[model samples]
Target: MPRAKRFYIPGCVWHITHRCHKKEFLLKFARDRNRWLDLLFRAKQKYGLEVLNYIVTSNHIHLLVSDNGNRDTIPKSMQLIAGQTAQEYNIRKKRRGAYWEDRYHATAIQVDTHLASCLIYIDMNMVRTGVVSHPSEWRWSGYNEIQNPKKRYAILNYRRLMELLGCESLDALKEVHGQWIEDSLKKGKPAREKKWSRGIAVGSREYIENIQTKLGVKAIHRKIHESKDSSELREDQSPYTAIFGTENERLRQENTYRWGLF
Candidate 1:
């Protein structure tokens, strides 16, 4: 089959995820998590990327991010980010070879509805794993950032997140976010489905269709590779986006200086 077109457009949001080899608790320790986060931050600074939301589970990670329009550096920046993370993991564990199972999995998010669904899926991941009763109870995710807006974390883009969520005021943003989490918690843990792979078993048909359009294909295929167990495959690796970059240069320009912000 022919390769599909890439979906790395300026201002287009994507839900990106990656998992460890064999679902082996790659991020079981605090240092492991911090190391990954540090590398991600450096990538953000170097590539002009913006993270809308993220969650780092023991074996996998979920990220909602958008191209900062830096077409020249997005790929290079991501390579550095993933490469450094893997290197650190191997060095700390005294092991060699792959850390994450495969290249990252990502779906371009084009609509507000899709954005809402993605956030819901990410926030409820811990609950689905039986680790927490509610999303707000999870400390390593954007749900906590929603709960405490005063606290700023490099991994989350709260202001833009609120704008995407249709927030006109701080109170409104908090109220809507809190309510969304409560709703997801009330739904209880997500049940695993056999046919669907990665993330919640179901999402809006519209969202899926939109992604298919962006991918320039009617269907998305997963090419699963083996070097691990069943749970490990599901836990640490996702056959997501292999490529993402923008073609527009105007969007790549830094507006901070123009606004007298820097």
Candidate 2:
């Protein structure tokens, strides 16, 4: 399902999930995945996107990033990466139609502990799918890049990531990252979390409410949900239904409209 109207508050971290059109295996090949990462690197160089973490799966991708106080950066970077990757793949394979599903969905995240959880959540995506036993096995993930920073062509903004995570240095961050993954695995199998993908905002009560306020009218009918450890603000009503006020907007219109009112 789609999220709440893509309302992004600057300086907030976001968990972005984008699937291939119709959930197809368009990026089933390694080269395609690598190309997608290549474009991500270009986005880093071009737009200064403060990437924190990412994972490219066969059918979709999970990208974690901070808005960095610039509203256009995230959208521009995503367009560059998604558009170029899709164009190149289509040209090479001679395919047609849409590449991605509508647009990517983003969830606002609170910094510190909540942000750490999102990072681990993105890391465990492949593991949850049974593609590999551990996130480390998935080379395309930010997991690999975090553990072993590239000498050249790096996509992540280490300084921003460190500041957001409250880490003193890269070593400290890496250690903490590894430990969190280990703890999650030991606790048992990880599952697909909807808050990261579908919710409007995921964090503490105050943080989520702040996001909702920033959204203003878009947050209408959206309510805050609390669990044992965290809180999320989500809309019970579908965005389509909220806008059109009907389960099926098409059905509400006369059949004569199929051939025009004339």
Give lDDT: candidate 1, residue 128.
86
Instruction: Report how far off residue 253 is in candidate 2 (Å).
Output: 34
lDDT for 27 (candidate 2): 90
Cα displacement (Å) at residue 176, model 2: 0.9
Tens digits of per-residue lDDT for model 1 on 1-262?
2223233534456677778887778788877777777777787677666777778889988888765655444456557777887887788679887887766655555446556766777888888889888777767787776666755445566667767788887678778878887777677677643312353212345544443343332123522222221110122232334322243323323321111100
Q: Candidate 2's C-alpha lDDT?
A: 0.81
Top lDDT hit: 2
Q: Could you give me the TM-score of model 2 versus the true structure?
A: 0.88
Question: How far out, in Å, is residue 44 in model 2?
Answer: 0.7
Q: Give the Cα RMSD of candidate 2.
A: 7.7
Residue by residue across 1-262, what tens digits does model 2's lDDT show? 5433454466678899999999999999999999999889889888888899999999999999887666778888889989998999899989899999888877888986889999999999888888788999999999988888776778888888889888999899899889999999997779777888888789998888777666555556778999888999876676544553333333323210111010
Whole-model lDDT per candidate: 0.60, 0.81
Off by over 4 Å in 1: 1-10, 72-74, 150-153, 192-262
